[model samples]
Target: MEHPLPECPIARFLTVLDGPWATLIVRELLTGPKRFTELRAALPGISPKTLSSRLRRFVLIGLVTRTAYPEVPPRVEYRLTPAGTRLQVVFDAMAAWAEQDLPRTGSARGADR
Candidate 1:
């Protein structure tokens, strides 16, 4: 028989958002819906292949919706679903923590060598 799944809420949430580059992608989407190319431009460090994979995972988890428009060139846009929008509070709390409690080391304070 298969083992029962874990009951922790944090673990459950992370399972959906724990893939490589997932948080960065969600942060980008928090700004607004974007086309694939636009998201690539905004997140300069992510490769096209990785971005595609992350988008696929987000769709699977129902956090994002991809819409396609028929045009001379097919147009696709990614937007956060209702579930995703609700995560903004979590993101905001994280941001607030970073700003308020991050260590004020010399490097963090921008002290030059």
Candidate 2:
């Protein structure tokens, strides 16, 4: 069975950023443009395959841009588009909500066991 896309904004947001790595990838790119190797280094546990997949999706969805330069080594850089940068406000709101409503846990995820 096929399901129609959700009309709710939150659902649409989740439809785009569904996986655990999606938001994390955006967060990393939020700092500045980075190469494939640099992104892998910045995100310690992320597999190269996963990073590539996310970046590709981001580019397709107009959230990111991938620029390849003609150089001896073939340099490529990934940067957030203006729409992606707007997500910072969403992140900020999430942080504020979590600080006020969510319980304190040492771990970043803060998932209750």
Candidate 3:
């Protein structure tokens, strides 16, 4: 059977956020505004190029805002907009569910060891 398209706004939003590194990037931004280097340090595995692309996409989607400061060395920071801040509710719910339903470690999905 052919798959039906997702019709809900939540589903549509997830499609954008469900991409690799997107959710993690959102989580990091939730804490506060962060510079490029700070986000890179927070998420150890993401490549600089990939992070740059994701930041661009997020800015385009209006979920994130990029601010540049004029200085000897230019500095840029990323922060979630009001629309993006609303997503924290969904993120919190997901985290709560995972904490309760998933095993802490060993043989379970996402277990470190």
Candidate 4:
């Protein structure tokens, strides 16, 4: 996202949620923690490399927590931090707006409509 002149606060937030993948990842994790394979299964659109890279960035930024189990067959799960969990409201509002307004504006398909 282009930094809006005059320093907008929402722009800073959008910088972290820069695209569909990041937001969708948050949405998936909102349901609860999930293993790598489960996230992949839930989000088939994202490639393994993209998912891995995005997850690393999320972890670095403290939006996500990664837990690895010690076992012969390792188990790893990704969970959202409290800050990340709060994003569910933002997503819900966005979804509601998209459903109600997008089609009227002819900018996007209103999936709910």
Candidate 5:
């Protein structure tokens, strides 16, 4: 069954990428396609279960695609769809904001007034 997204654009975005892992996973995929082991290695401290869960959620939401090939041991690759690639602009904007707006450690810029 298909689920409707929230009316608000921000809410809809949050509904799709609700957690840190979601965006991080997308960021990794933005570089290129990767296998399970590669993704696990790239993201240290992320449990296999969590990675699997997030990938499955991404596949369900149309952000990622999983392709499996038949072979001796079998191989699987995960890649971002066009919709997923579109998130690059959002990530770029976020990076720009963080670099320009967010303060450094111990800086008074972001401190309480």
Candidate 6:
């Protein structure tokens, strides 16, 4: 069911969350900071190009912070910002709902296919 635009806080949040990939990114980051390669490994289905783009967008939106270490190989890491961490409760609630309410699909709530 669709609700009126800009009228609800959740709707606005969803707008920022946007696409399927964004939520997945958020979910993964909930674990802790991770390098590009780590994220790529965790989300094997995501192409490098798309992951780069989403990380860029997340950085721009203040939901994520990218730190580049001045090392020989230039290691970079991504972590959620304070505002981003605020969504942990939301993620937890979703997990609870999925475990209690979703159909038993013989896998996780949002497991990669």
Which candidate comes out best when scored by TM-score?
5
RMSD to true structure for each model, in Å: 4.8, 4.5, 5.7, 4.9, 2.4, 6.4
lDDT of each: 0.84, 0.86, 0.88, 0.86, 0.89, 0.87
- The model with the greatest lDDT is 5
Q: What tens digits encode model 5's per-residue C-alpha lDDT throughout 60-100?
A: 87899999989769999999999999999999998887776
Per-residue CA lDDT of candidate 1, range 1-113, in tens? 15544599888878767854788789989989999999999888899999998898789768999999998689999999999988899889977866755555523432332
lDDT of 4 by residue, 1-113 (tens): 24343368787787678898988888899999988889889897899998999899889878999999997799899999999889899989998988877866577664556
lDDT of 3 by residue, 21-52 (tens): 99999999999999999999999999999999
Winner of 4 and 5 under lDDT: 5
- Give the better candidate number (3 or 6) by TM-score: 3
In Å, residue 22's CA in model 4 sits off its true spot by 0.9
Winner on TM-score (2 vs 4):
2
Could you give the candidate ranking by TM-score, starting with the highest?
Answer: 5, 3, 1, 6, 2, 4
> Per-residue lDDT for 60 in model 3?
81
Pairwise TM-score winner, candidates 2 and 6: 6
Error of 3 at 17 (Å): 0.8
lDDT of 2 at 31: 90
3 or 4: which has the higher lDDT? 3
- TM per model? 0.83, 0.82, 0.83, 0.80, 0.87, 0.82
Q: Count steric clashes of candidate 4.
A: 0
Q: Give the per-residue lDDT of model 2 (tens digit) for 1-113.
A: 16777899989899778976888888788899999999898889999999998899889889999999999899999999999999999888877877866747644454543
Tens-digit per-residue lDDT, 1-113, candidate 6: 25555888977887768877888888999999999899889887999999999999889879999999999989999999999999999989988878866757755545544
Those runs of model 2 whose alpha carbons end farther than 4 Å from true positions after fitting are: 1-4, 101-113
Model 3, TM vs. native: 0.83
Q: Considering TM-score, which of the candidate structures 4 and 6 is the better prediction for this target?
A: 6
